[model samples]
Target: MESRFLGIAELTDVPDVAVVVDVMRAYTVAAWAFARGAERVVLAESLEDALALKARRPDWLTLKDGPPAPGFDLVNSPALLRGTHLAGRTVVQKTTAGTVGALAVKDASLVLCASFVVAGATAGLLRERACERVTFVVTGGGGRAEEDLACAEYIARRAGGGAVDAGPYLRRADASRSAAELRQGVREGSTPEDVALCLEPDRFPFAMVAGAEDSLMVLRRVAPVDPPPSA
Candidate 1:
């Protein structure tokens, strides 16, 4: 069977072994955070809210984060996580889009995170594992989008053992309009390019696990099956 199709906006859906796509940035940012040696991350939609969480935590908590721009230390760029630059840093990043989406799915079943970088891993995890169902939730601008929904459809197709279909989402399952309507108004920035990296299959081994906090998720770095070429 196809398991089931769910589209919730929060992490409580993790039990469904949900696939959360912040294709615009949050999911992408989470990818960069883990790539940069961030042991953990507290996702926040608003910078004000993210900083407030940091205020309560002790100094032992190393922190780093930023905007969606490339110059910022924590912009949603996976390229930013390259080399030995972030050997021992734990980040607490804030993005206008992806973080907010993560905040929305705080109660999901497994809360596996994705971007262009970990797409293959996401699909493999979904297919090889046994679960009740899987939800494909994309945050920012309802649900329809150029990249997010395309990303979602790509994933859903992979999980369901269907053919690889890269066409845009449609209004009706049979409509000509490409792409779902929920992905409208997605944020525009370097986030898209970052998303491209997330689209690549099995490039890295990292997944986001939601913590008890409202806007935070634990980033666990999985052991690489093969040597990553000079990331």
Candidate 2:
């Protein structure tokens, strides 16, 4: 098995299995949504697309960052989502980094969304697949996306049969620019629980695997088969 790290710009170069990391909030919110019983998450390229999808499927919920869009259901904050009941419902999610990066990978046989919340389960899923080539797509662009990079490295190390500690990576994510932005969002009346929720490593036991349905990228939670024994 081989693992390579790439940025959002290299989405086209992803290999057999691609793990897209967005530790600040995107994938973290996704993980929480799934845990809250969301049926499926549709990846939208932009806010316009998300709103359009919602208009078409009136029952589907719309989730996006920043201010709420017209006809949108919720903002992209896991803390807010924690209180909502999403059972048996579909969600249309449009994020600047995570969903866009995930939808842009056209070649990979399998694409998984990653964050500290689901990192261990994601690495477990990769190890179970035993893929020949795996690429970690850091969706927050590269140099400035410390949280995403740290998550990629942690997943790679765990997928490679290494008994690595997640403490260092979590610390790195806590100090990232993305984390700072989330903190600022909290002060501005955004959910104060978001920063802590995003940084909580291994909060979920399943991986968010991306698949196509009707030409749309959809994410669903998948438990790793025969997960590695806990350290």
Candidate of highest TM-score:
2
Q: What's the lDDT for all of these models?
A: 0.51, 0.83
Clashes of 1: 34
Reference-based lDDT, residue 51, model 2: 82
Model 1 weakest lDDT span, ten residues long = 170-179
- The candidate scoring highest on lDDT is 2
Model 1 stretches with alpha carbons more than 4 Å out:
1-15, 56-73, 80-84, 161-199, 213-216, 222-231
lDDT of 2 by residue, 40-117 (tens): 999998888888888889999998877765788878888888888999899999888888779777457999998988
lDDT of 1 by residue, 190-228 (tens): 333343454454455644555555435655554423322
Q: Ten consecutive residues with minimal summed lDDT in candidate 2?
A: 184-193
RMSD of each: 6.9, 1.9
Report the Cα lDDT for residue 125, model 2.
Answer: 93
- Candidate 2 regions off by >4 Å? 12-14, 186-189, 229-231
